[model samples]
Target: MEITMYDTLLQLPLFQGLCKNDFTNIIGKVKLHFRKYNADDIIVEQGAPCTQLIFLLNGEITSQATDNQHSYSLFETFGSPFVIEPYSLFGMQTNYTATYKARTNINIVTIDKLFVLNELNNYEIFRLNYLNILSNRAQVAYEKLWNSHIGNTEEKILNFLVLRSMKPEGKKILKIKMEDLASLIDETRINVSKVLNDLQEQGLVQLSRKAISIPALEKLTEKNK
Candidate 1:
């Protein structure tokens, strides 16, 4: 494998904390499914079966999540060293929650879900990491669910971003209309615009004609706290 490939593999959470030998052995034992895409190419569609664990090895990708019934949608951009919907691989859904598109020329590396269950689970560190990832997602989701109805407009907006994201710490770009956003959070359009402007003044977000960009989600979360 190329050094770049090795570095990329190690960057993913599932492969972190594994010793060098284990990493090499695991790679040698499996055939990595690799693909490349041009900007604007569709990587996967929403509701498609997530039969493998896909790693964004290079470049950037944008994902769109539409509400059930196609009422509204949320779009987010994620860079490399990322995984696409790991939690969806084995759950009752077993399908991608969003449609992902290439935002730049990108490389993808995937591991079959069967290999994940039958092979990757053999490594104790890998198992623990997977458990931690899934458990964190579930616990955060449960807590968020309980608080879904009680936050103020600002809190509701922040929770909207957090609950819809793939991870809580990355720089994320969200594409949605002002009115659509307000409807999703159960606030009026005027209220949503006011809170968004306040957030922009606080330097927590940048508003554009087409989208809202968050430089660092962690900062927004901390400021809210």
Candidate 2:
């Protein structure tokens, strides 16, 4: 079945609870600019000024952040029609928190920040949705900060696995290199290798050159608990 833009909007968390009428009103009020990107294209650089809300209409992208040591950590990978850091559009910094690069040929829709602000003020539902989105982002940020401070290597590894998995059942494949994983966790390659070996021996993960697969995600979650 073919999906319309309205259908795509409905799939997004930011547009949840908005009816067809709301979407129609939004389309009438806001102009959407469409663009395409090839694999490895940089959509936005970290710390770059951001004045538009970007939506991934199709294909894959990864967001990465650089630390004080200039090491890059994979933040998140996103698929179609999802907003890229909506909260950043409003804050005083008005800068992208991470660099977004196309992981595949991609389609994008962008709306100016002024249009977003106008909609937020004119529509009660849009205002509430925007606020809720910001709140959720803040909560996730808090959890990441808290987790960084408290966990041991093993615990942190398990927590990171759970987060990357995005669920507690079915197989989960991590498309990352061991070296990058080490950089992500700020650990040495040898240490990260040892930890992965321990997890493999315990039957929580299966390692291969291309990916790490968790056959039973629950087993990894059990370690986190």
Candidate 3:
């Protein structure tokens, strides 16, 4: 069982460069923590303090962020071997930016910040991997902003979603009213509605009252490109 766990750790981003020997040493060094959740279970709520590095081992989960005024929530789904916002751990706003929930039976392993600071930091490879991930996230965000521009109403909406997304490709859910969404994207309500209707007709999104469900963000991205 421990062997399987070590192998799984190797697949996780934060532990990627570490060899089997390193994982074994870490396991022996700390009281490893594990947790599980059933489908639809809430793993963590938005604004909660992030005191540990939470790694999703298997299954899928979604992270949701709400606008400050609680206008609408943005959600993005990700699969296994995921890390839940590692950058939040040491920032001025130490709270998790989103609420995360399980989309399947999920298993997670977490390393407390203290161990990450005192012990994991001692490993040169581990420190480099950590720094790389943080740097990559910042760089991606910076580059994406340059790509964000107002095009057609459809492209405007797509850019809005993609810019806020954790990953460019995933299942996405945008819960906002037509007027609110239109105002945010700087499009007319009628134009927004017309484009959304056209998208729905094309089977790209399923629209209901105040919600737009995108089953495959990648498919829509591919179609546009």
How does each model score on TM-score? Answer: 0.85, 0.73, 0.94
| Predicted structure 1: lDDT | 0.86
**Candidate 3 at residue 22, lDDT?**
76
- lDDT for each of the candidates? 0.86, 0.73, 0.88
Write the residue-wise lDDT of candidate 2 on 1-225 in tens digits.
134867886677667778888778788878879899999999999999889988887898877665445333434566776788787887688898778999899988888988877774577766787899888767766665667624666776666655533223556566577887777777778887898889899998888874676677777766677
Candidate with the larger lDDT of 1 and 2: 1
Clashes of 1: 0
Candidate 3 lDDT by residue in tens digits, 61-94: 9888999784999989999889998999997899
The pairs that clash in candidate 2 are 56-81
Superposed model 1: Cα runs more than 4 Å off: 68-70, 170-180, 201-216
lDDT, model 3: 0.88
Across 7-85, the per-residue lDDT of candidate 1 in tens digits comes to 7799899999887788899988776899999999999999999999999998999888877652556677788888999
Output the lDDT of residue 128, model 2: 83
Among all windows of ten consecutive residues in candidate 2, which has the lowest summed lDDT?
Answer: 66-75
Span of ten consecutive residues with least summed lDDT in model 3: 143-152
